[model samples]
Target: MSTDLDYLQTVLPAPSARLAGKVVLVSGGGSSGPGWSIGKACCVTLARHGASVCVLDANLDAARDALCAVKALGAQGIALQADVADAAAMERAVQAVMSAYGRIDILQANAGIGKVGGPEDIALADWERIQKVNVDSLLIASRLILPIMSKQGHGSIITVSSVAGMRYLGYPHLAYNVTKAAIIHFARMIAQQYAEQGIRANTVVPGLIDTPRVRNTVAKMFSADDFEQAKAARDRQVPMGRMGTPWEVANAVAFLASDEAAYITGTELVVDGGLIGKYV
Candidate 1:
């Protein structure tokens, strides 16, 4: 018998080749510290579903590590280091993927950063950094890739947002909240504008997911230094009595990236383990 923790750690293969022959580009496809970050899990999950993956991260080592996992699944993939928020770097990154895979069928704009402060308390620089990484990067990626996707006559753009975007999660991080909300609408706008061009756009909103980034940043905020306490507190907040895993979020991305979601567009997929639905 397997436990939930076992399930969370395991990376399951696709039930079908729903994404066969497709190419996927995932930004921020690396963990901030260790374990499976959401973007890394998306890269692996897309690869598992028969899509060639390109793992792009500012950290070269992390990107390479993710690519290794993709290749281990017997899927074609490449790793590159680029700042997703830098226009020139992102353009170059997109071109590199085109060169290696010929075309990009899916773009997972997953790069994001969070700071635990309200507008009044947060440093101006921190606010700008959060916006650039969490919001501007999505714009840059979409602006560059939309034309190519239009030419292909079909593509999928999955931007990662958060439950923080939807509502207050008992946090005072104004910048982070605003950026996350912005991406949700950004995807919807693209979804409508490019629908005729055969490009689909959607947002994946995850809540209280147990990832390295959260452990390093949010755990400290939640528990005032105790990791286990942070985890327990977050778990109790969720209606399901636990935080979600990156793999579960990746599963949602994989679905949106596949043809199975052909008619789905201009929407947000909330992967919060029922937290978003229950009243506090």
Candidate 2:
């Protein structure tokens, strides 16, 4: 039988030149807890594929770290700090990108936070915070960039969503789920409204991603043995028998943002290791 490492090597597609000479912006392009997270992976992957990347995060230090990783790959990258929910800040970020690279070709809206709470128990403040960061931020950022992209005559916008928005994932985060669902719709609307303008918008949905955020959250929710057991059960649910890594999701984002996916828009690319296909 082939090992997991061998399977990954054989199954994963290598980076392509689909984004050659493009300028891409990745919000939340930084490590949130530990190791490389989805946003970080996307920044580096886009850079490796020949795009000059602008890594933006609320945490300047983390953004710099991600930019360094992209540079280490011998690709062009820059770090920018901005609150995704703030329109003026996002406009400033766009200006910086334009000054550095002349034009933007791709916009990856990936900033978000996860808090577990059901409707009855979730605080209004918490719900608002999640909505602002997860949904409003994407809206504002896209609003700022749409004109720039429209003037450029072409662009791609990719939003990162979660499987929770599509189906139950044994989590009780109502606000998070709602915000993600809204994001998918938002992308669809943008795709249709701007199709004639040469702009494409799509969503990349990831399921049970094995990132630091998931690890820490799971650790807080379950005992060590229970956590391991739960992870095993989650793996069993996936046809691929494992949770996907950040790089896996990053590859999907790269494709959706690149010219390779020019004919694709207003659709979802699920990178869930086949977990979303399982009924149970």
| Best candidate (score: lDDT) | 1
Off by over 4 Å in 1: 1-9, 218-225
What does the lDDT read for residue 129 in candidate 1?
91
RMSD of each: 3.2, 3.9
lDDT of 2 by residue, 50-158 (tens): 8889999999988998888777666787899998988899999999999999899999999998688899999999999999999999879888899989999999999
Task: Report the number of the highest-TM-score candidate.
Answer: 1
Full-model lDDT for every candidate: 0.88, 0.86
- Candidate 1, residues 1-280, lDDT tens digits: the string is 1112344335675435888899999999987877889998888788878999999999999999888877777788999899988999989989999898889999999989888888779999999999999988988888899999999999999999998988888869799899999999999999999999999999999988998877777665565657787678889999899999888999999999999999999999999999888744
The C-alpha TM-scores of every prediction are: 0.94, 0.92
As a whole number from 0 to 100, the lDDT of residue 106 in candidate 2 is 96
Q: Give candidate 2's total backbone clashes.
A: 0
